[model samples]
Target: MLFVEAKWLYNDALTFMNDHDINDYDSKTLTVHVLDKDRQPVTHELRYLSSQMRQSVIQGIKNNMKSLATLRKHDRKTGSLKYKSEYLSINLQQSGVTYKFYDKRHIRIQGFKKGIRIEGTNQFWNIPSLEFANAKLLNLPDGYYIAITTYQTKRSEERKYKPSIGIDMGIKTTITVSDGRKVKVLVEESERLKKCQRLIARRKKGSNNRYKAGKLLRRAYQKLGSKKRDAANKIVHELLEHERLYMQDENISGWHKGLFGRTVQHSVLGLVKAKLMKNERVTVLPKSAPTTKYCPHCGKLKKDITLFDRVYECTCGYREDRDIHAARNMILLSGLSTCGTQEINAFGEDVRHWQNSAVQPR
Candidate 1:
């Protein structure tokens, strides 16, 4: 009900923005036009969404306007914000005022009198001196989730790290590590997902059966997303244990338009790369670096190398798996290349990095 009312307010506010200033549309009683169960237009009143939530929705419109204007200033092609059929997230504008934590497993929302029991509080419940900030109540297809913004002092332990390693991203195997580890990446859609998709195509459009089928499809996609995220997290955790990681900035998305488009769709390589790059320990070699063509042992470029070659056989008597050879060479190449430092976080709120390099003549 909260999400439905919020969506109504958002669409109503967007409609109002089309004619008048959004700042002028902060009325307590929001009247909007919505389709009825019989597929006829009907007038509806938004009474569930709180004043703060409504303001957040309006402020969202103002923010969109600002973003569009900024894009136009940069001469980028832009489009006006359109009315949405659904609003997936509602900003809890302030911490204590809009929402409050009653206990570890329960929270109270401003519009609701009774406390809502939430299960995932165990994630950050034990942290001492944690201060809650603004948060978003997300209406995911599978369930409702509140993503809270919290602040805590950084961990003071100057940690130990493992020896540095280099990585190679490739088509045959997803990740090849300098330490002789190859991790394949692929997550296929579940049988239930395929069934749900087929069921939707057969259901009549605009009917209740179709609506139910669409909901199931969304749930399946959400489940698929959870699996991909889990797989990416596990892979990232294992790789980031090293002190200084090196990898070329290969264009994974470009590979999507080529022969392995379907394979790329089933793989979590893109997510793994994004998470790895966020860590300061990860060093991204430039895109132009010839990880495969350059040989570390011979100190020469193997210009005759082709995609069909599985083994890197150098004139200097270095014979190795092609992927492993490329992975090892990443460590060598990064030392010769110049790179700037930047700071970046998991959420990409701040973005930058620094990498260790050793000077060696090629």
Candidate 2:
């Protein structure tokens, strides 16, 4: 009931915003007429959704509007927000006020009279000086989940630091680290997923069986997504343990359009790239820097390399595995290239012309 009402209110607010400015839309007096599953119009008050939930919906729309405006300001192609058919998340804007932890594994929401049982609280239960902030209630395919944001003081600890490393992302083997490590992170589709898809396709449209099949399909997708996230987190955590990281800004989207698109997608290359980019210690080289084509030994670009070549052979008698060569080049390029000269220009070359000329022998 809460999620349904939130969706209704969101669509209503979006319609109002289209006709008028967001500030002019009245949240208190606005009433939405909802329809039953049989297409009968029924009127009701905002009983299920709390005041904060309604406010969160409005704030969400406003934030999306601001984001679109920012994109337009930067000359990006923009589009209007479409009405949502389903709403699966609600934001509890305050911790102590809107929600409170009753115990280690139970919580009370604003509208509910009794506490709700929750799992996965054992990790943060016994921690000292823990502070709770805002939380989100998620309606997922498997079950309901509450994600709480908490803050705690950092504990200083003695740490062992490893040498700086570089990584090259590839479709064949997810990542190739500079220290001669090739990690494969491919989560192939399970048999259950394929069976669920087949069942969903066989069911008649608009029937209850079809609805059940659709639920199963969603659950399968959710499981697959969880596997990808777990793999990415583990890989990133291991990589960040080093003092520094060097990686290239790869063209993952272009890989999606190529012949090996499905291979790249299944391997989760994009997710790994995105996670690595967020780290403060990671330095990203330009996409046109030719990490794979440039010979690290002689500093000459080999334009004849193809995807079929697993080994990189240079005219200066330098030979190595293609992916390893690219990973090693990340370190060399990071030292030779300046921070300000990292972005490429329209000619598919670095913006700094002198840096290119300086690298070539006379």
Candidate 3:
């Protein structure tokens, strides 16, 4: 579905409401839903929400603002971008809906006998996590145009593959496979995003210069997100060529909470995880499996191995790249004995039960 956003209209609405005292609203208990032309609940038309929903979402922003303020306060610094002063608006997307754009100015929300048309589409992607609630516009941001669409699948059934591989996500490297192949994703987009953010900080608040900086920052972030998603899609497509995929249940979320938060956040590991989970053929090994520390040949646990140790050296002289070792272990752990069973014993539990499960993109 295509997302349409109208920030200009939203700002105008909020400005109008704020100028007049509309204090009867509670943000926490707000929601929005779409209604058909007959005033009946619409299934796919984007739901316009009430003002209360706007207030509830603002709490998240307020908390973020407070934390940012505290950090800046401790550092003894000041800048533009007034977080608390800024208000929020809500938007929604309709599913299984259709729309026809007569002109660039407006379009229909599509579902009932008559459709709802609104203005603005310039800054659409800014809206996130759109859904429906009831028949009223619950906390929907004012003046934003909406796009209603239906999601469809291009492929009827998932394509089958014969080859299979296991992957290990890493920090220094993008991904390490059991097969000794390495893929390094570019991080230039992240660095550029940071630079844009810094530039935004230098601009004066509410000024044209500041607005320009903000636009630049938004564009940079959008580009970064797009790049990461494209890279992820390509990787998933390539990996699916194999009949099966084995991967460790690495603590990717934990990495985000750690020192390398930037790298982890920008990485497509999370996307990969989601895709794999969706596929039936991909089997995820448990988190407790010693994919890295255990020697594949001698079966000896290398307890002292550190992140810097790229090469896995065992007492039995089974030396290989650490990533390759991990990837290969996935094939062993994923024992497909009868059909195409390549049995390889692991230091952990036998994952033979997974053979019957089809691997998804996750």
List CA RMSD, all candidates. 7.7, 6.7, 12.4
Cα deviation in Å at residue 335, candidate 2? 3.0
- In order, candidate lDDTs are 0.79, 0.78, 0.56
Question: Against the correct fold, how does model 1 do in TM-score?
Answer: 0.85
Q: Which stretches of candidate 1 lie over 4 Å from their true place?
A: 30-41, 73-76, 336-362
Q: What's the CA error at residue 190 for candidate 3, in Å?
A: 6.5
For model 1, how big is the CA root-mean-square deviation?
A: 7.7
Query: Number of the top candidate by TM-score?
Result: 1
Candidate 3 colliding pairs, count: 34
Give the per-residue lDDT digits (tens) of candidate 3, residues 1-362. 11211222223223333455324323423122333335564333223432333443333345554776797979966553331223332333232223444544454443334444554443433444433222222222222334343233345576667577887777653787655568775445567678878988888887888887787777677677778888888888878787777887777788877677666767787886677678887788776666677665655678898888988888777788887777776666555422122233444333334333423343
Candidate 2, after superposition: displacement of residue 283 in Å? Answer: 2.3
For model 2, the local distance difference test gives 0.78
Worst 10 contiguous positions by lDDT, candidate 2 = 338-347
Question: What's the TM-score of every candidate structure?
Answer: 0.85, 0.77, 0.56
By TM-score, highest first, what's the ranking?
1, 2, 3
